[model samples]
Target: MSDNDSQKRAQFLAAYDEQLRTDAETPSAIKVIVQGPLRLVTFLNGRGFITYKNLGGADQAAIQRLVPEAMAYYQADAEIIRVEWKTRGHDHAPGMHEALIDNGFIRDEQESIMIGEASALAVDVPLPEGVTLRQVTEETDVRAMSAMQDEVFGDPVSDDMAEALLRRLAIDPGMELWVAEVEGRMVTAGRLELVPGTKFAGIWGGATREEWRGRGIYRALTAARARSALNHGKLLIHSDSTEFSRPILERSGLLKVSTTTPYYWKR
Candidate 1:
């Protein structure tokens, strides 16, 4: 990376760490419970999320106290069976990783935080013959798409994911569920979350069938979503991308700002 590109990435990381992550999270949660410096978010279907800005500059002793306390907050609720503590690479909280591990949180693989101008990704991408893309809203289509995504990711079909998507659709119309289908069968799917009151829209869960990989369908789907985000007045697109999707986003002009690792604790 050039010096200017590195500086730009640093700036984006700082803005994202301080502002976008927390501000965007609050509006999406069904309930946000604050514990000291942490925001304990309760999502639909018994999922819990723990995050905070800079851990409020906590020292080692403070981090040790806060880590378990946050986990305890989730454990207190019978509905919350799983909790993920979202960590950023740039966070300065001492012994945070150790604290989470000691408290029974299992670490998940890290992902790159990709950000870029929405307009940069709004270019046209040719789709394969007989493949069609469109936004989906109905529960039947939503469930089908979710199941397809689960199968693509090597996880069993999750009713919870389908239910959560339906619930979110009822409350938040800003969310767009897009799918690419061949002859009416789902082949690719993803979600675009337009953060209300922010310049960012997040593209998540981009999954394509193994047989359909390398056909430019995923890229076309991303472009379609980016066009929609731009139409809705968003200037930037962000995603916590896996190895598979990272190169696709980079091809669309997004820069890797930082890394995020989610440490999960199951009760």
Candidate 2:
């Protein structure tokens, strides 16, 4: 990358860490505990999440001590059947991976942290023949969209995610769910979340069916969401994208600001 490009990436990453790594991340959490720089968030469906804006320049010994202490905080809460410790590639913490593994946390695949202007992605894109995009608000449509997403991600189709989404929608009107359909069957799905008190909106849960791959349906769906975000007064867009979707966003003018990996622990 050129020096100018590197500087731009640095600026984007800095803005992301400053604006997004705090309460914007866990807007709907049932509870949040502050332990030093860490935000231990308890969400619905027995899920606990851990994240920090920065580690305060902690050394290996300090990180090692912090990991188990955070783990214990979740372990003592029997209701939290599972916990996810979110780690970013740009973080300065040393021995974080080993410390998490030592505490029975299993690392998951890493995803690119993509960020860019929402207007850059709001352009009109033609969809595949017979494919149409729309924002879904009804329960039945939401469940269908969630089920299709689970199937695409190779997980068992269940109501757990749909239920959680419904609960979230009840309180967060800023969260919008968009899906692409063909002949009344869902082929692509994702969400646009307008973060309150910030200039950022998140495009998350992007998934497309196997048969729908390589088509421009996903891009069109993203454009629809970006337009929605822009309409809602959000200027920037952010997403933790898998390899399948990262290239698409990069092509749409989003930058790979960093990487995020979630380490999981289940009781």
Candidate 3:
């Protein structure tokens, strides 16, 4: 990469870590506890999450000690059946991986952190014939969208996810849910969250049916969300994208700023 490109990536990563590593990322948390540099969050759906802007320059020993302490906090809460420690590849923590593993956390797949101007993704992308895109707000539509995403991601189709999404919409109606459908059947879907107090908006939960892949349906859905983000005055777009979606977003002008891996633990 050219020096100019490298510098731009650095700036985007810096902005992401600074603006997104706070309560902005956990707007739906029911409870948040601060333990040193760790933000231990509890959600209504029996999930615990851990993240931080940085490690406060802590060394290996400090990180090892902090890991179990954070775990014990969540363990005491029977309501939290599972927990995830979010790790950033660009972070300087020395022994975070070992610490998490030793504490019974299992590493999940790593996703690329993509960021760039929302306008770059707002360009027109033609959808296949009979496919249409629109924003969904009703409960039935939300449930169908969540079910399609769960099926696409290989998770069991359940009402838990739909319930959580409905609750989230109740809390922040500004969060936009977009979907691509063919003749009244949902084929692709995703979400747009306009982060308060920042210029960034996140595109998340992107999923397209296997048969719908490579048809430009996902790209068109993404463009619609990007246009909505731009309409809401959000200039920057960010997403932790899987390998399947990373190349598409890269082609849409977002840079791969870094990587994030989630470590999961269940009761």
Candidate 4:
């Protein structure tokens, strides 16, 4: 990478760790319990989250101590089904990987953190002949969108996820749920979340039906979300992208600043 590229990646990484990774993840939490330097966030839908600004520059011994301390806090919560300890590749967290594993946390696949200017992604992308895109508002449409997404991802349709999304939409006007449909049947869906006080809007949960892949429909959906972000005055767009979507986002000018891996502990 060029010097300028390295500098830009460093800046993006710093801002992400400082802002979105800390505050954005905690705002919607049902309760935030702080243990030492970690934030243990409990969500309404039986999910627990753990994060911190930095591990206080802790050494291996400190990490070994801190991991279980944070895990114990989540263990006390009966409602939590599983907890995810989010790890960033660029962070200087000593012994975090080993510590989490020792505490029964299973490592999941890592994703690249893609960051770019929203304005660059707002350009029009031509859709297929019969596909249409729009922001969804009604309950039926939202539920349908969620079902389609779950099916695309090979997960069973979840009523709880749909209900949680509806509750979130009722309160957060900046969160936009979008989908693409063919002949009134949903084929693709995603969410564009505008972080209230930040310069970033996150594009998340993007999924397209198997039959709809490779026709640039997902790209069109991304452009739609990017347009929404631009309209909301968000300059930057962020997504924790899988291999399937990483190249698409990178093509739209997003840079892979870092990688994030989630370690899960089941209760």
Candidate 5:
């Protein structure tokens, strides 16, 4: 790719990645890395999730065996039956796609993995009338954020997940959730996370109410978080967005570097 194309891809990926913090939802698919023969982290919500760190040089066949074991782990739990295996395009994920497809995994739509300079995303966005932004720090604010996020995503209300997010916030996981409130109601929301070891910050769960759509609140919220990311010394901002978000981020000068497809399987 030419320099302009490369930069364009990078910008989009950076805008989609959310930061790491206690308030970050574990989503049952997040596995806390631990020591073992095959260290795996599984997150179980309505579905199962499997994420592993750099495998200890495990071959493809050994890696292939992991699914059944993981399936068994969540199989008995009534809450989980399906699982998503998130793959990074840059990772040496040998046999990952084949293994998943062989196990009845269906792939979701591919999304561009866009990453770019945070400064590029710090452009100004004008806020709509009676709407303002704030950083959520308290448990109540966290729950409210989670509730708004669910509504934005079109998921059923999940108090369990909402309460869980509040608990993480109470632990003070350094994650920041921001909302564009109209009058006293949250009409749009987003989260910013500064990853500890990487030069990146992620913005996630950006949503706006149907009636509140397209008045510049989402863009303004993104700009606010982009400014926040700069204060933390973050050089980049990233997010994995749906079609709705991808276009907005693209217009903001973020690049879409590569694509990520989540293939899911059920036990």
Candidate 6:
């Protein structure tokens, strides 16, 4: 890899770590916005969710303290269930994965941190002759997008996920949904979140109709989203890709720097 490539990757990782610290998790289980010299993100998701930019600057005692406080915050509510601590291998986080394991939090499968220059992904791609693309932000359109995405991803249809996404869109948080249609039927769709307070935007739920693969529709939609991200001043684009989407993203110049996986803990 070239020096420029190395620098870009480092910058992308640094920004990612910092964004995790500052992003407002959600309305779920009151939020505790912790102030940290490095980067820290704590969320109340039943148990507790803690992830920091890196552990290079923190001692073991500091991390241990953080865990108890985080647990207490989540435990305050009887409804809270379980907590997870997300870790990144490329981060300056020393002994973090070890610490979580020591504390009874298990590690999950590593997911690739795919990042690339926005410009490289801004090329124009034409959809198949019969298909076209449209943006979905309205409630009905959002539901359709969600349903199609669920089918493409092999997840059970979830009205709750649709409701949550609609709620988020209602706030006009700059989240966008795009769809590919053939003869007036929705075939594939995805969501792009223009995360506020960060120089990066994320593409999620990029699903293609199994029969519609390799028709260039999904790529065109992704390009359209990339152009939008660039207009929003986001130079870096990121996604947690699977086998299907990873190759397509790699073809667009995004590198898989690391992996992330969520391990479930049930009450």
**In angstroms, how far off is 101's CA in candidate 3?**
0.7
The weakest ten consecutive residues by lDDT in model 4 span 19-28
Cα displacement (Å) at residue 117, model 3:
0.4
Per-residue lDDT over 61-103 for candidate 6, one digit per residue giving the tens place of the 0 to 100 score: 7766655555555566676576666666665555555555655
Work out the TM-score per prediction: 0.96, 0.98, 0.98, 0.97, 0.77, 0.81
Candidate 5 is scored at a TM of 0.77
Q: lDDT by residue for model 5 over 115-225, one digit each (tens)?
A: 667898898887776889998777777778788888878898788766655655655454678988977788988888776666778888888888998888898899999
Deviation from native of the Cα of residue 59 in model 5, angstroms: 8.6
Note the Cα lDDT for every prediction shown: 0.90, 0.93, 0.94, 0.89, 0.70, 0.71
Q: Is candidate 4 or candidate 6 better by TM-score?
A: 4
Looking at model 2, how many pairs of residues clash?
Answer: 0
Clashes of each: 0, 0, 0, 0, 34, 10
In model 1, which residue pairs have backbone atoms overlapping below 3 Å?
A: none
Q: Mark the regions of model 4 whose C-alpha exceeds 4 Å error after superposition.
A: none
lDDT of 2 at 235: 93
Looking at model 2, residue 106 earns an lDDT score of: 98
Model 1 lDDT at residue 60: 90
How high a TM-score does candidate 1 get? 0.96
How far is each candidate from the true structure, as Cα RMSD in Å?
1.3, 0.9, 0.8, 1.2, 4.6, 3.4
**Order of quality (TM-score):** 3, 2, 4, 1, 6, 5
lDDT of 2 by residue, 149-198 (tens): 99999999999999989988888999999999999999999999999988
Which residue pairs of candidate 2 clash?
A: none
Model 1 agreement with the true structure over 52-133: per-residue lDDT tens digits: 8767788999999998888877888899888889998878889998999999999999999998889999999999999999
Error of 5 at 238 (Å): 1.1
Give the higher-TM-score candidate: 2 or 6. 2
Candidate 2 vs candidate 4, lDDT winner: 2
